[model samples]
Target: MSGRIPRQFIDDLLVRVDIVDLIDSHVPLKKTGSNFVARCPFHTEKTPSFSVSRGKQMYHCFGCGASGNAISFLMDYSHLGFVEAVEDLAAFVGVDVPREIGGDFSASDKEDFTRLYAVLEDVAAFYVDQLRTGDGRIAVDYLKARGVSGEVARDFGLGYAPQAWDVLLGRFERDALIDAGMLVVREDGKVYDRFRGRLMFPIRDKRKRVIGFGGRVLDDSLPKYLNSPETAIFSKGKELYGLCELLQKKSRPERILIVEGYMDVIALAQYGVANVVATLGTATSKTQIDMLFRYASELVFCFDGDNAGRQAAWKAVDAALSCLRDGRQIKIMLLPQGHDPDSLIRDEGKAGFEQRIEQAQVLSDYFFDFLAGPLNLSSIEGRSQLMTAARPQVEKIPPGYFKDMMWRRLRELAGSRVVELPEKPSTLNRQFQGKVGKAKTQRPSLGRRVLALLIQRPELAQVLAQRHLSLEGLKFAGQELLEDVLRRIALEKPENGAILLEAYRGSSYEKTVNALAGVELDIPEGGEEAEFFGAVIQLLKQSRQEKLTELLAKEGREGLNAEEKQVLRALLRERL
Candidate 1:
């Protein structure tokens, strides 16, 4: 096993994998002629413009201009990392990824993930078995007392961890159990089950695989709820309690209701409101917000009306500031004091609970109300304070209609004491700067042409290499990058364009290489070799001409050195 996945395997996987089939599994594609077309999943569009070319094993969206191969498509659509995408493709094709044995990659890195997930699954089963046994009466009674039916209990994979500490210790290997976050090792080196005598709720990912657990005590415990410690498989800030189940109900629900606890989600589902999720004992995160927005446009947060609930709602607002965009909405719902979503929903039935969600305060109103709650807007001091606090939060939002409207609302609130914000460089200004740099690099230069052509048709590099072209003295902005890319292509001999792109993943020239890869050239099909060689030859000639001009100027300033004179004579002979 290698530390890094072998490059040859990745290229082979891309060659064997079908982009059309892979994408259709996620976003259905319809065959139109030799290619396939679908509504672009990356952006909202009415007509089908996303095209998948079976010949090239690549997909491109005309609407958004998003273009990539299978691996890139999976990375974008599923939000997977590059290696994970490659792993998925490898899994699809039924091949084990062979990695290099030596470097930073270790056996533990691979073994731990597999072992962790397996141990978690086994531990969840143990808890479930405990729930079914005679000793599980306490857990069963607790669920019944909470009005959780047997079917719902089973659906949520509710279980019971035994009161005995060694129950899990006896069943599984100690290290595996500890690594899965099922056991705690004290300083004395004594290990024990982390969730003893607690009713268990297995937290699953989108694949319905149990990644971690949330344990609630059957009796009076200070913490009340205990979640699995952050493990390789589970990050509290990233996972939602019932998201997998909610998504099972609706792939894209109209609106998702976010509650405060696990029971709140299960309770809401019991009451026939199935589109509810809960943050795992942590404050809502921007990552979770982004994930939820992928499934639903609107998110409604239900919190208790107490100070803690208000604090939680405010924290959610802070996290949501940077995530807000046009067409996405967030609402804050505060239940009556002394009640959480579980208690309130139980009291007010499904209809009343849902009514609260419907009448929930919009994010804009809640934001201003919370900001001004402690300040007197009539006084300049209070308004100044508001401006001081609000400006930073408002600026976190990406520029769009939402941001503009927020600014307008701030002005209305500030009234006579509106703060004049310092003008910063606009996004357009940054884009203009980038364009200027791009224009400089892309000025119909032979170097730029050759680089772009190589990225688009990397196999042409082999031909260029075979020509034994001497580009040693070539000097240009992107000349080194061009040579590096050509050298890699000539050595690796990657048959897929995505594989070539993937090779540049973390290189300094990754951005430039990707940008050039997307550049549309005027050369027709089968003319890439001619264009590539033509550009390379012209670039080399231009370098020579520039070198000759410099040497001639040096001769005028001072007599040329022996070496410089020889070079000048050879250049003059070549010119004649």
Candidate 2:
């Protein structure tokens, strides 16, 4: 059980696991042209905005900003850590994760995760075994009473925790229970079971490894449900119940419905709503929402009718707005009065509950009409308050045509004759003005121009360096970045930008690499290159003079350091 998984093993595993097949599991990808096309799972869209290039082994979503290789997609979509994602991918191709050369598990940082997985599996088996016993009959009866079928219970990995706390604590050592995050020990040295007298629901990762558990009390208890605390293997914020089974099915859900409790999820699935999942008694996070977007074209939030539910919906809406792009859509379904999903399924039946889903309001409609309703547009003060409240939400939206439409909608809502408020600034117009002003004020520095030229045609590197081209005059924070590039070129004698990037593999200059690699250099025509070279030399000379002047001012003639004196003499000599 050594930690280090060999790099070649991971690469071979990736080769075995077809990228297209892996991506297809999460999204409904149709063959389009040379690549596969699917409605971007990262955003809600009617038309396809996501494309997977099989040849390139990359996927990009045009609607949302999700672009990544196979590993990245798995990590983001499955909410798995880098190592966990690799292991999951490896498992899919039926390759064993390679162990380190030695018995030491420190080689790969995944040893803790691997051990946790083992512990969770053991706990799941214990729970399952307990559920089959006579004591488990109470848990089964409770589930049946709540309309959870045997199939649904099995599908969800439902089990039973005995009423006595020590029943579980006695089975495992204190360290083992603590490692599993199944027991909490008080300051008095008393160890207490995290879940007792409750129905156990195994929390699984995308690869279907039970990483944690959630337990619901069979009867009246202070806290109805208790979830496993965050452990090395479990993050409550990033996990979604039922995602593993849904992904395995490879059926793209039209819309993902997010609910609050585990019972709600079990209840929905029991009633044939297999696409529904519930947060682990926590607020919806951007990470969870992002994971949902990977498998679903649209998202519908089903919250309770109470004030708490309304507040949760608002938080979800705001979170979605921050992460969701133009093509993605989000809808909100507020359950009818005094109805939880568990109660609703029992009361109204599946079809009746679906009708409520059909009536779910789009995010735009919810924002403009429902959520923003408290602000009165009849009064001037009310109009001002509405605009103030709306600005921050609107600002959260990335700059684009969609933001413009939203601004116009806001102005129309707040500035109409009923309210007759001032017209809001157009996002596009402001962006255009800012771009023009920036272009006018900021001229490209000689150092930047030289670096760009070198990056575009590294043959120019020798010519530029031979002329003693210095980047000291550049008015940019990318000074150290340019220096790193120059150092790489000097050390490696790279014939091109690509070679230079390869040579500086572990350098802290990746931002420079990205900029240089992604951007097209504007090489001027005719004598412009010579003119640029001359300007660079002149700037360097001027910068040298300024350095000398500063040194002289700081340290008088009598107090002049050797380096300072030599630098002063060099500047004067250069001038002469």
Candidate maximizing lDDT: 1
Q: Summing lDDT over every window of 10 consecutive residues in candidate 2, give the lowest-scoring window.
A: 432-441
> What are the per-residue Cα lDDT tens digits for candidate 2 across 326-363?
66778999987799998988888989988888889988
Following a full C-alpha superposition, what root-mean-square deviation does model 2 have from the true structure?
10.8
How does residue 198 of candidate 1 score in lDDT?
88
Q: Which runs in model 2 stand beyond 4 Å of their true positions?
A: 1-83, 87-109, 416-576
lDDT scores in order: 0.81, 0.71
Tens-place lDDT per residue, model 1, 176-280, is 888888889999999988988888999998767799999888889868999999987789998899988877777758899988889888877777888988999
Q: What are the runs in model 1 whose C-alpha is more than 4 Å off?
A: 1-12, 24-30, 38-50, 61-67, 76-81, 98-105, 325-327, 416-496, 500-576
- The per-candidate count of clashes, in order, stands at 4, 3
Model 1 C-alpha lDDT versus the unseen true structure: 0.81
Which candidate number maximizes TM-score? Answer: 1
Q: In candidate 2, how many Å is residue 103 off? A: 21
